[model samples]
Target: MSDKASLAVLLCNLGTPEEPTPAGVRQFLKPFLSDPRVVEVPRPIWMLILHAFILPFRPKPVAEGYKGIWKEYGGSPLRKITQSQVEKLQQQMSENSVLVDYAFTYGTPGLVEQITHYRDKAERVLILPLYPQYSCSTTAAIYDQIGKYNLGQRDVADVYVIKDYYRQSLYRKALAESVDAFWQKHGRGDHLLMSYHGVPQAYADKGDPYYQQCLDTSTNLAADLALAEGEHTVSFQSRLGKAPWLQPYTDVTVRELAAKGVKTLDVICPSFSVDCLETLEEITEENGEYFTEAGGKTLRLIPCLNDSASHIDMMAAIIAPFVDVQATGQK
Candidate 1:
C-alpha cells in the first residue's frame, strides 16, 4: 500500500482473558484493575490489597464466571465479538480505501502494539473506543494509553479519537430498531429496563459525564421507540466494591419491578456496544433468576448491536466525518 493508502481506524474495547482460567483471568485483571483510571483508590494501598486479597480469591470465581460464558471458539465472548465487529467494519468500509482493526485496553492485541503497527503505515489514524458514552474509566483510559504510546515515539501520526456518540442519531436509531425487532419476535414485555455499566458516584461527582450520557441515550432511545413514561426505566449495573455507584442499581430495580407485579421484562444495555459477561451472564443468567425469584415470569435480554449490519452502518456513519476531515488535510 502506498503512503496515501494509509488511513486506518482502530476500534477499541475493554478486553477479556485469553482463556477462561484462573491464571488467565488474573493476568487480565492485574493490569486492568491496576489502572488508576479504573480504580481511583491510592495506588500503593490498592496494589497491596489487589495482590494480597483480590488476586488470590477473586480470579477463581471470576474465572468460573468466564467459563460459563466462554465461547466455544475458545476465548471470551468479548474478544470474539469484537473481532467480528472489526472484520465487519472492514468489509463495510472496504471501498473507502481505509484499513480497520481492533485492540483491547487490556489483554492481548494491546493498544500500544496495534497503534505502533499502524503508526508508520497509516498517515491518519482514528482511535474509536467502542464505548458510546465518555467516562474517565473507559474512554479516558483509551486516551491515556494512546498518550503514553506517543510519548515514546519519535514520529507520531495524526490521530483522532471519538470521545462519545451517546446521542448520535444513527446510533440511537440502531438501538431502538434492535429493541423493536426483539419485541416483534417475542412480543413486547411489560417493562423495558435500560441498564448501563455503573461507575462510582465519586467519579460522576468529580465530572465524568457517563451517568448523564447514559441517561441521554436511554431517553432518546425511548423516544425513538415511542415508549411512554411507565413503559421503560433506566438503571446502572456491574458495580463493584462497596462504594456507591450511579443508581437505581439494576438488580435492586429489577427486584422492585417484580415485586410491584410487573410479570414480564425486557432489558437492554445501551451503554455496551457489544454483549459480554455483564450482559450474557450477569443480566441474563443471574438477574433472570433474580426476577423469577422475585415473582416475575420472564426477563428477556436484548443483545447488544455487535457486528449487526445496522450497527456497522452506524459505526461507518460515525467515522465518516473524521475520515473526510483527514482526507481534506491530505490535499
Candidate 2:
C-alpha cells in the first residue's frame, strides 16, 4: 500500500446497545443521554436525574423496546443495519479504489478502532456522518468523537469532515426510489407519513437546524414523489421528556388521520439511515398497532434507507465529488 494512495472514507452513525437487556440499554443510553450536547442540562443536576432516576427506572422498559427490535444476528437492528451499510459502502468504494469503513459514536466498531485503522494506513481520510441532516445532538456528537480520536493519533493524517448531505441530489433520488419501490411492493397507501426522530424544541430554538432540515427533506421527497396535499404527511417521533419537541407528533397524527377516515398509511423515517429501535419497535410494532387500533385498516412502514443498492449508489455519489481523483479499473 503506497503512502500516497487515494482517500479513505469513513461513514459514522449514532449506535445501538450491544444487547436487548436492561444492562445493555443502560450502557448505551448512559453515554448518549449524558452528553451535554444531547441533553443540555447542568452536569451535576442531570447526572443525579440520570443515574438516580432515569437509568434505574428507564432501563427495563427501554430494554424491552430493544427486545422488540432485536434481530437473530445477536445484536440490535441498528448494529445489523449499520454493518450492512459499511459492507455495501466498501463494495462501492472498491470500484474507485477508495477505502470505505464505518464506526459508531457509541458501541463496538468504536471511533478508536476506525481511527486506528485509517490513520495508520491512509494518506487522506474523510469522515462522513451517515446522517442525512445535521443535529447538535447527533452530528455534533460525532464531530466531538472525531476530534477526540484525532487528538490521540501519533501521526495525524489529513482529515476532512463531510458535514451534511441532506439535500444532495443523488441522496434525494435514492430516497424517492426507495419509497417508490416500497409502495410498489406493498401498494400505495392513502397517506405517506414521513417521520423523523425528534429533538427538543429548545435545541431548535437555540439554533439546531435539525427540524428545518427534516422538513426540507420531507418537502423535497414529497415533491419528487408528486404527492398531493392529502397524499402525505410529516411528523416527528421518539421524543423524550416533557420538553417541547418538533410537532405534530407522529402518533397523534396517525390517530387523527384514523379518526378522519384515513384507512391506510405508509410511514418512512427519512432521518434514519438504519433500522433501529426507533424504526423497528416504536414505528413498526408499537405505532403500527396504535394506528390499526385507531381504526386504520393498515399501517405499512417503508423501511429506512439502510444498505440497499440504491442507498449504496447514493453513498458513492456523495463521496465522488469529494475524492481527489477517480481510480481506474480499481475493483
Candidate 3:
C-alpha cells in the first residue's frame, strides 16, 4: 500500500473545549448545542433560549468546571486521554496496521476535517464512536455529520460506522476489571452506582433507546461483577436545560443513597469512554459534595477506561474484522 494506510480507524469522542475558558467553552458548545439530534428543540426557539440563557450564562460556570479538571499540560482530560487511546491503539496494532487517529465531535480536528483527511488518504475509513450506548443525541450525531460530509462528495471513501458496541463482552469485561482494580486499591463501597450521561426524556419517548441501552450496559456489568440488584444502581448525569432528563437523576440518586445510610459510595460512568468535565468535575467534585452533605462518608469516582490496556484491546477486537475485510479488498 506504498507505506500509506489503506484502512483508517478514527476514534470519535464527545468533544472538549480547546481552552478551559468561557470563550472556549462557548465556541465548542455552540455547534454542539445547535445540533438538532442533540437538543431536540426547535432551532428558532432553542437558538433564542440557547443564546439568551445557555451561551451567555452557562459557559462561565462550565468553563470553571473544565478548568478544575483540566491538566496543566494537556488542557482537557477528555482530549488528552483520547489522544493516548489512539496512540496506544496504534502501537498495539503495530507499524503496518491501519492509521489510528482520533477526533472530537465538537472541537478541533472535527468530524468533517478528519473525515476529509482520511478520505483523501485511505481507501476505507472506519468510524468508531467511543459512545458505548447509542443515543441520537450522541452516537447518531456522528452519523449525521458523516452524512452531511458525504453529501458534498461524489466519490467519498468507503466508510463503516460502529454505531454502538456496549454489548461487546470485552466492553463489559473492561468495566468489571476497572471496578475490580479500583476496589483492590480502595476498599469496596456500600454501593456501586453506574451513571450514564442523560438525554432529554422526550428523546427517549421518541424511541431514542439511550435510556434502555444504559440500563442494559449496567445490567451486563452487574452480571460480570456478580452483583445483586441491591448492590448497585443505575442513574443518569450531566443533564442540561432540566426539561426532565432520564429519571433517577445521578445527583438526586446519590443524595438519596446517602440519606438512606449508604456510606462510602463508589460511582462509575460507563457511558464515558474518557474522563471529561462531566465525569471529572461534575461527577467527582459536585456529586461528591452532594453525597457528603447528604450524609455519605465517602464518594469515590472510579476512573474511565481511558487508554487503558483493556480498553485498547477492546478497540482492537472491535476493529479487527474490519481490518481483515480491508486487507482482502472487500468492503
Candidate 4:
C-alpha cells in the first residue's frame, strides 16, 4: 500500500454499538440521537429530554434487542459487514494511487478522524455514505462533519460526496436482481413489501428529499419486478418518538396485511445498504412476530446487498466519475 495515494474512498454507514450491551448501546446512541440533524428539536429542550428521559431508559432494551441479533462470530453486524466492504472495495479498486477505508457515523473510526487521515495523504477524497436515499439526517450529517473538519485544517483534500444513488440504473438493477434471486430460492411470496427506514414527517414537509427518494426507489423496483398495484406495497419502518412519521407504517401495514388473510409476505428494506440491527431484529424478529400473530404464515425478510459482487460493481461505477477527474489531472 502507498503511504500517499492520489485518491481515498471512504465508505460510510450508520454505526452500531461496539458491544451488544447497555453501556455500548448508550455510548453509540448518545452521539447519534444528540445530532440536531437526527432529532430536530431545540437544543436546550432536546438535551433535557435526552438526558432525563430517553437515555436512562432506552439503553437497556435497545441493548437487549442488539444482543438478539448480534452476528455469530461476535461484534455488531454492521461493523463486521462494513469492514468487509472496505476490504472488497479496496481489492476491486486496486489502482496503486487509490486507498479504501470506512468509518461509522457515531462510533469507532469516526468521520472527522478518517477525513483528517486522508487530507495530508490524498489529493481528493470521495465520501460515500452508503444510504441509497439522501436524507438531511444521514447524508447531511456527513457533510456537516466534513465541513467542520475543514474549518481547522489549513490544507484540505478536495471532497466529492455521492448524495443519492437510488436512481442510478445499476442500483435499481442490483436491487431487482437481489429480490429475484431470493424468490428463486424460496419461491415467490404472495405479496411484496418494500420497507424503508422512516424520517419524521415534518422533515419531509420542510423539504428533505428522503421520503420522495425512497418512493422513487420502491416505484422503480416494483416496475423492474413487473408487479401490479395489488401485488406489492411500500411502507416506512424504525420510526422513533411519538411524533408522526412517513405514512403506512411498516408494522401496522404488516399486521393489517396478515389480518386481511395475506399469508406469505416478502419484505425488503432498500434504504439499508447492509443488514443491521433494525432490519435483522426489528423487521425480521419483531415484525415477523407481528405478521405471525396477526395470522400470516411466513414473513420472508430479503437481505440487504451487502458487499456483494453486483453491489460492488454498482459502487465502482458510481465512483468512476471521480476517478476520471483523477486520470485527467483535474484537481
**TM-score per candidate, chains pooled:** 0.96, 0.93, 0.96, 0.96
TM-score of model 1 vs. true structure: 0.96
On the 0 to 100 scale, the lDDT of residue 238 in model 4 is 91
lDDT of 4 by residue, 1-331 (tens): 4356678899999788888888998999999999999999999999999999889999999998888778453777888888888888888888546788998888989988888888667778899989999999999999998888778778755888999899999999999999999999999999999999999999999999998898889889999999899999999999999999998999999999999889999999999999988898999899999999999999999999998888998988888777745544457
Q: Write the per-residue lDDT of candidate 2 for residues 44-135, one digit (tens) a residue.
A: 99999999999998999988887766744466677677778878888766656577877788777786678777765666787888889999
Clashing pairs in 2: none
For model 2, the stretches where C-alpha displacement exceeds 4 angstroms are 1-5, 72-74, 151-155, 326-331
Model 1, position 303, has a per-residue lDDT of 91
lDDT of 1 by residue, 174-276 (tens): 8989998998999999999999999999999999999889988888998899989989999999998899999999999999999999999999998898888
RMSD per model, one decimal: 2.1, 2.2, 2.0, 2.2
lDDT of 2: 0.83
Tens digit per residue, CA lDDT, model 3, 1-331: 5555668899998788889899999999999999888887878999999989999998998888888777543577887788899999999876444888988898889977998888767778999999999999888989988888888888865889998999998998998999999999998999999999998899899889889889999889998999998999999998887599998899999999999999999999999999888888888899999999999989999999998999999999998877755555555
Highest lDDT scorer: 4
Q: Each prediction's Cα lDDT score?
A: 0.88, 0.83, 0.88, 0.89
